[model samples]
Target: MPELKKQSQVPSQEDFARAKSKSRQFDEIAGRVREAVLDEFRERAPISSVWLFPGQDGDLNGYVFYFATSDVADSLESGLSDEIEKALVRKSKELIGSGCSVIFDSHESVVRKCNGNYFQYLR
Candidate 1:
């Protein structure tokens, strides 16, 4: 009978400490990004309709920001503070291009659904 090798031991305290530090840093960065995106959304889109789906592994690891309508979505995505607009789009492209299907649902179809048409609300 062949004997199986023993599994590695749990991480040491020092290892855990290092991991905790890195986790804190990651959280700080995430908070900054969250603030930036949300602020931009509020400034450029309708307050009630804007939504920011914080990224996670299961949820496409990116946001699903939506507006009341496609027109609002487009304006938010393109007409917001130029700095924030560019940053948001760049992050989106990077996330999507990196094997994650991050989406920017403009709600164009939904807007038409409300009016019984298609692409009718874009402006």
Candidate 2:
């Protein structure tokens, strides 16, 4: 007969502390990346928000950003990926340098759907 192994029924305080520390560390890294990207985009893009998505296998290394529409027209343009495309494409390398993949959510297709189109809205 094979011997049965047992595991802890409940996590210990040390385990909780370790988990908390890891979460804090991840948040710190993600926050830094978000701030850096937001700062960079604010200079030339209509950035509404920046986010850092945790990477694969528990690594903190993924990013996504959204655009803020100033007006309906501006929304259309921005959503069409017109205003931010140049900047995002240009800054892809720089953003990725922070150890995460970057995304620019211009909301282009979303705008297109408003116009009853489900295709890329070229500016």
The model with the greatest TM-score is 2
- Writing each residue's lDDT as its tens digit, candidate 2 over 42-84 gives 6655555555555664433332334433432553465643434
> What lDDT score belongs to each candidate, Candidate 1 first?
0.48, 0.50
**Per-residue lDDT tens digits of candidate 1, residues 1-123?**
999999869898999999899667655644555456677666655433222233454332333435445554555556553444455555544443222233344444445564533224322
Candidate 2 lDDT (Cα, whole model)?
A: 0.50
TM-score of candidate 1 on Cα atoms, chains taken together: 0.42
Candidate 2: worst-modelled 10 consecutive residues by lDDT: 114-123
Q: Which stretches of candidate 2 lie over 4 Å from their true place?
A: 1-5, 58-63, 68-98, 106-123
56 Cα displacement, candidate 1 (Å): 11
Clashing pairs in 1: none
